[model samples]
Target: MRESLRLLRDELSRINSPDELSSWKERFEELLREAVEKKLGVKCRSPVYLFKTLYHAGFINREELDALLQFDELNDPSFFERLLERLETRL
Candidate 1:
């Protein structure tokens, strides 16, 4: 998971156009969905860890990180919905 997130961060850092950014956002949302589904037990921490890592690494700004972290306080069932909503707004 850490490796995956790192790779994503690397790709995110290389993005130079809006199309690339949009693609990245789609991939990110997919990753979040997968984590929520397959890593049910780690859902709470995994996404937060990845997002925080990205923020600290300068891949994402403070505002984006804060919005993503908002899911931390949400119930498990609402995680995907909230994340999708945030991502849509970002796009």
Candidate 2:
């Protein structure tokens, strides 16, 4: 794990293009969402609340949010709540 992290850091340090950065940014977003889902059970009740939590955690920003949530459409609290609830049921 440490070696993988070191390689990822090296790759990030050499990133040279907006496109490359954007791709990495998307992967980062997915990982972050996964982590949040795992840790918090995805019970967010509002987009604002989710956004605030992610922002506070420094896991996202304006551009990433715009891309990931497609300008906040995916921020639907009901959707996240349902997703978490479903995962909980499965567990």
For candidate 1, write residues 1-87 as lDDT tens digits: 545555666676677776776677657656755544454433334667767765654545786677777643422323333444444
* lDDT to native, each model: 0.55, 0.47
TM-score (C-alpha, index-matched) for candidate 1: 0.46
- Model 2 Cα lDDT, one tens digit per residue, 1-91: 2233334445556567766655644443454455566666674554455555665555555544454455333433333333333333332
Model 2: colliding residue pairs: none
User: Which residue runs of candidate 1 sit more than 4 Å off their true CA positions?
Assistant: 41-91
Cα RMSD to the true fold for all candidates: 11.9, 12.1
Model 1 per-residue lDDT at 47: 63
Single out the weakest 10-residue window by summed lDDT for candidate 1. Answer: 72-81
